[model samples]
Target: MTVSAPPAPPAAQRTPPAPAAPRRRRPIAPYLMVAPLVLVLAGVLLVPLVRLIVVSFQKYGLDQLVGGRPSEWVGLDNYGEVLAAEEFWSSLWHTVRFLVIAVGLTIGLGLLLAHLLAKVSRSVRVIMLLAMVMVWAMPPIIAMPMWRWLIDQRFGVLNYTLFHAGVLPTRSFNWFSSPVTGWTVICAIVVWGALPFVVISLHAALTAVPGELVEAARLDGAGAWRVFTAVTFPAIKPTVLIITVLSIIWDYRVFAQIWLLRDIGANKDTYYTIGIWSYVESFSNKNFGLGAAISLISVVLLGAFSIFAVRSVLRTAQAADAEADAR
Candidate 1:
């Protein structure tokens, strides 16, 4: 009788869980919001880039394009022709030189300006920022002509003023006559044109530095210079690298300054960047294939730089994650 009672008590049933209501999918509202931007980018940027890449491999001449002969594929022959040409190599070297000088000048001056402006009062900082913006907003063409005029030999205001002040030996110092002098002047103009953007970007980055972090460094016995080198430098380094890379790219493709100077009777041979060489190949020599090849080489060089940039970003991200984990 006791065994039968225990067995009856052990037969209690377990309840099953209630089925979960099917999760309503999240509304696609955010993606829909970005659709306009996606469309704009595809239309304005991506389509053009794809077209350019396709046209680059084709043997299309100005005449062929106009007459509608239809461009035929030429494979790597165009690239071989570009590589075999002396002018292409020389132009590439010139571009490399310009990039080195321009990037150095831009980053060095920009960092100095950013550091100085970062320490200024709020109102003064705003004024400085506005001034930088004004320069940045001005077109390159505007500044190019002005620089050309200022450096002109005969009937130039800068030379006239210098001669009146007895600073220069003669009233007509040829600024763009000599190849060496012309290149120097062109590089100076390019650096000046690029400086404002560098200054503003780095200034913004510097201003974003955390005061608490800076104070902590000071508490740990770091001096102004030490704190800047150790803390501020590290914090703004990513922005600095980004700006430097952009400057490198811009400087590498500099054509207007060189062209303007050349038009002003300066030696076109003074500074022939890859851009100028490509232009000459296409329009001057009517060799579209060689021009396309030169452009592709330029693309490869820039691509290499981009690869380096990506690696740098990835390394920095990994280091940051490691540091966070350690903390």
Candidate 2:
């Protein structure tokens, strides 16, 4: 036991633990894959946005635009001018009116169509859905002109039918001569064009509703209206809200339809929505700076509305989740 302890296992033979291998870094393949998309989006969207903001602050004119030279910096002058103009307020009012009427009618009709599609036989539903898809696929530019032709003052199918049916006092009735009629036609066109997508989306949402829940409600002697209000609606409420917000945004910024049909009205000024006004200022009037300012204001207003809608929806959803958790 006292033997020299085998010389303490010779120091030279002792082995120390090796340092851990450096952690292999995560592969950057994912980031590399997305880099191109990020670059493209920045170029297309971010660049233009920055230019718009910059132009809005400057006194940009045709000379500056053509020469590619920086214009005089007019701090807030463009914004001030736009805000002080009566035309801006008038255009805003027109936009609001169009948004309200078009969105309301579009959503109402979409819900009706979605409900009908949900109830119908598979074949009929498929046929109706296909028809809707066709309409939705049609470009607005093409559809707008087609509508104009159909309602034209001369040789128009609508006027011909109405006159023959005794619904019109004259064989050639001018639909666009009066502001009331012009706006009505415009709203109708927007509603018709928007309906297909809304209906399809709502139909899809409706189809996701639990059949058991609906049947249970029915077995409990709940009427159709009661069953829909209590069971079906709650499930699709979020979808409806989202579609309504989207519709509002779409109708708020409607341009091609209004612009194409502006001259149809006796007073073209009557149809000057914010979109039309922006175009007129930028292109027609060659006041690019003022137009950009108008556009920025419109964007701010729409953005505010969108934020409110999103927040409301989120609150409702969170409250629902909380209630479920408590239950």
Candidate 3:
């Protein structure tokens, strides 16, 4: 054999990529499965959103809807009109006030309830929880009228009792007659409706607290108050934050109670929020543009709140997860 490299075997041909593992097609599978849901959401939500945006620029009225097309684009005129109006600003302030009072009271009451419920026997806890849930489960319409009846001038049990007990001069004091009083009643209704959920969430979170950690705190000469502040409180702080954010969002969108109160006698001009204002402008005044603009503004404010809440949640969750992983 010639010592010359026996005709060097051609470099073994690279086996072509092992056929790419049959291209396990999964990414597009998830998308295909979700396509129906995407279509449904687009039809229900996005379509209306697009129309609302368009109408926010166009002039549309009930009569126009009956006989014509949207004729003109007002550019920023609708927004300017809303911003320049005093009621718009007033309504926004009222909404913030309502949210602060309602959410504060709700959280406070909920925390107290959760704490109390945690110490009670199981039977008693269930009874109390069921009672609270009854209030929460009641529809706003039902609760609104019932609360109104309770505060009614002549027959309201509240005023009647106050008068009979000599706390009031007469039974003629109507809670919804004054804006401040009406607002307070509305806050109470909202708190009553919202507190149950917070209580339930917080109660669960509290129960999840490690018993050994609590025992250790107690053995360390920590008083009940100190143990709560240092251990139990910190553990439940995230739950409280979530509850507060939810309550704020709920109170901000409250319209049924406020609207019913307004219908009963509360001054629309005095007791208003972005929701009520948008409704009145859109339906009563036939100002779709103004209504949409007001709604968009409200959405912007809510979006900001949601962003803050989400960021807070992410931070807390990340911290908890890190702690868990470290353990």
Name the best candidate (by lDDT).
2
Residue pairs with colliding backbones in model 3 are none
Candidate 3 residue lDDT tens string, 1-327: 657655654568545455455666567878989999999999999999888888888777776666676457888888888899999989989988888888888888888889999889999999999998898889998887788788888789999998989997878986767788778888888888888899999999999988999999999999989999988987887788887888888888888988887766746688879999999999998878789989988988999989999899879978877876886
lDDT values, one for every candidate: 0.81, 0.90, 0.85
Show model 3 residue runs off by greater than 4 Å: 1-23, 27-30, 324-327
Check candidate 1 and list the clashing pairs.
none
RMSD of 1: 4.2
lDDT of 1 by residue, 29-77 (tens): 9999999999999999888777666767878787776787878898877
The full ranking of all candidates by TM-score, starting with the best, is: 3, 2, 1
- Residue by residue across 37-108, what tens digits does model 2's lDDT show? 999999999999889999999998888989877799998999999999999999999988888889999998
Q: Residue 108 error for model 1, in Å?
A: 0.7
Give candidate 2's error at residue 86 in angstroms: 0.9
Cα lDDT over the full model 3 = 0.85
RMSD after Cα superposition, model 3? 4.2
